[model samples]
Target: MTLPDFRRRKAGNQRISFVTCYDCAFARLVAQTDLDCILVGDSVAMVVHGHPSTLAADLPMMLFHTESVARGAGGKFIVGDMPFLEHRKGQSEAVSAAQALLRAGAQAIKLEGAAGNLEIIQSLVEGGVPVMGHVGLTPQFIHAFGGFKVQGREDAAAERILADAKALEASGVFSIVLEGIPATLGKRITDALSIPTIGIGAGPDCDGQVLVLHDLLGFTEKPPKFARAFGEVASASVTALRAYDEAVKTNTFPTEKESYA
Candidate 1:
């Protein structure tokens, strides 16, 4: 289904859950669940490629992961993130990047920022490509924002955040992802918008929630403070890998009964 349909569903008070996936395996697992969307986030820079931040993720890397997720999504809606610098070249560049992602099987595209992005978003929307708006703690602007700090903490900042949220909605975005904002501000934005607000560190009052898949699985050695581990996959993965190594060293694998005749 189109993202607009999903937005309508969300507006009817249905909570949507989005999960991040960087590869086909995780995308397959996500498809088995009831997740409404899968975001091929540039956070893959940190979680998969061992980068210190998302700034290190380039478009080719993002497209690689986006295609992998798309292959395993099994028809689920996929949103591919426009990596840093992909859209900074202007509206035409943004459309080209977004079009490449759509051809790569993404149902939608997400870009950071609010002010400089309205034209890009408008262009994409006009071309029948759904756009998911992301603001508050936009990792792409880590350099400008001066590191991964909490946004909307001050009065002026909070007002700007609110204004940005409204402006994004006015630009025909299907939904907005509010990240790392104060709970009160998140709640107010949620209350004000017709489109659903998907929160990452925003709060429980948002219309829906999203988390990086690795963060939820505890695969990251140090996830963001707001991330809650729903499973000990990290520990389990280590144990399983260790066991496999031990079995191989001991010649315990490929047993007689386990081998093909």
Candidate 2:
């Protein structure tokens, strides 16, 4: 899907399907499907590189993965994430960082939080960049929130998050990601914003839903409650690997039909 599709989907009440993909192999697989879009999320630091948090995702890392994803993404729209603090530096730096990602092949970029970045968002949009805003449990603010906990649980916090969503909408974000908040708040934000809300841990009432590819495929041993494993790929992969090991041990892998003259 393209940038305008995000708004059209929300207006038509059609649920958008977004998934995070890091590399070309997975991007190729996702491209073969009808998924709405692919996000080369900062979560790659944690999911693919084994970092404890997304803060470890630097601009270089994001560029590398975004380029890889773009190569195999086919016609899929790709949104590259602005790494931690990349946008906080300054207008010039932020735009440069965004330029690099776009040049690397992202159709758009997603950034976390709107509190201190509204002007930056506006600047990027004014400069003709498509941006997706993310609020609620912004993983980039993990330390500020004291961990990957639910946000907007209390009345005041909920109000703040709702405001953030609206401000982002005003700032021209085509869509926003609502993460780790109560179901009621998720619905509240979804209703408040004209742009689509892509929830992850935020609940099913959103205009759309997004989950990390690994979590959705059961590759994560301890995925969060909101992530439902639609497939047991981890276990299935292990079983296949074990069979291969056995075949190799028995010298049966290159039997007559599997060998060349």
Candidate 3:
């Protein structure tokens, strides 16, 4: 689907589905699913590169994954995430960073946060970069938020988040991702925006929902509270590996193929 198609889905009350993918194999796999968007999320720092935080990964790593995902994304819409501090320097830096991602094959870039990020988003949008704004428990703000806690729990905070969403929309974001916020506020923000809201840990009321592929596929041992495992891929991988080890140990793997000689 195209970026603009998300707005049409919002208009129709149809929910969008987004998932984070980092590599070509998974991107190709997701292309076969009914999902509407594949985000090459910066969560790759934690999921693929064994980093404890998203900040550990840089723009080059994110761009590498974006290229990998785009190689196999087929016709699926791809949103590349700007890594921690990738665009934090200033609007000029943000525009350059975003352009780098777009040049690497991202259809759009998901910029995290308000305040400083809002101005960057406006600058990038004006520069012809399609942006997806992210707010509410943004990982880049984890240290600032004192951990991955839910945001907008209080009236003032909720108002602030809602205001951020409004300002982002006015700045020309095609869509916004509401992450780690209360369900009531999630719905409130979703209802407040004309553009589609794709939620992760936000709530069921968003125009779309997203999850990390590793978390959703049961590849990660301990996923976040909001993530649900739809498959036991890790266990399946272990089982397959054990079987392969046993076959090789018993010298049975090449027995059938030996007949070709």
Candidate 4:
């Protein structure tokens, strides 16, 4: 289904759930769930490659993950993220990166910015590519903001956050992801925007919520504070691996009865 249709459905008070994935295995698992969307977020820098921050993720890396997730998503909407320098170069570069994502099987592309990116969003929309807007605690700007801190906590910054939400909506984005903001401010933005607001620690008042898949599965050694661990897959995986190791060391695996004649 198109993103506009998803937005319309969400406008009726439907709560959309989004999860980030970086590979086919996770995508396959997500496709079986009731998730409304799967974001191929650049968080792969942290979750997959052990990078210090998302800024280290490049276009090729994003494209690689986007392709894998798209191939395994089945029917879930795949939202590919444009990495740090891709969009800042100019409108043409943004369009090219977005188009490449669509070609790689993404149903839409998400970028982080407001005023500086309206033209790129408009151009992508006009060209028939669905776009999701991301604001608040944009990791790509960690240097400018001086680390991964909560945004919209102060009065002036909150106002700018509201303005950025409105600007993204006006630019024709189907939805906006509000990350790391106060609950009251998130509610206000959700109420003000025509498009749906998907929050990740932004607050409960948002139209929907999203979390990294690894975080949700308890695979990350240090997940964000706002993330609630839904399952302990990491511990379970470790236990299973340890069992296999013991079996191999004890010659308990590949018993004679298990061998083919």
Instruction: Candidate 4: list runs displaced more than 4 Å.
Output: none
Residue-wise lDDT of candidate 4 within 189-239, one digit each (tens)?
Answer: 999988889999998999888999989999878788889899999999999
Displacement of residue 136 (Cα, Å) in model 4 is: 1.0
lDDT of 3 at 230: 96
- C-alpha lDDT of all candidate models, in order: 0.89, 0.94, 0.90, 0.89
What is the model-wide C-alpha lDDT for candidate 3?
Answer: 0.90
Q: Which residue pairs overlap in candidate 1's backbone?
A: none
In candidate 3, the residue pairs with backbone N, CA or C atoms under 3 Å apart (3 or more residues apart, or in different chains) clash, namely: none
| lDDT of candidate 1 over 56-165, digit per residue (tens) | 88888888999999999988889999998788897778888988998888989998889888987888898999999998999988989899999999999999999999
Model 3 residue 159 distance off true place after TM-score fit, in angstroms: 1.1
| Local accuracy of candidate 3 as per-residue lDDT tens digits, 55-104 | 88788898899999999988788899998887888777788888889988
Q: List ranges where model 1 is wrong by over 4 Å.
A: none
Q: Give Cα distance to truth, residue 151, candidate 1, Å.
A: 0.6
Which of 3 and 4 is ahead in TM-score?
4
Q: Estimate each model's TM-score.
A: 0.96, 0.98, 0.96, 0.97
Off by over 4 Å in 3: 256-260
Candidate 3 TM-score over all chains jointly: 0.96
Candidate 1 local lDDT, residue 203:
89
Error of 4 at 103 (Å): 0.8
Per-candidate total of colliding backbone pairs? 0, 0, 0, 0
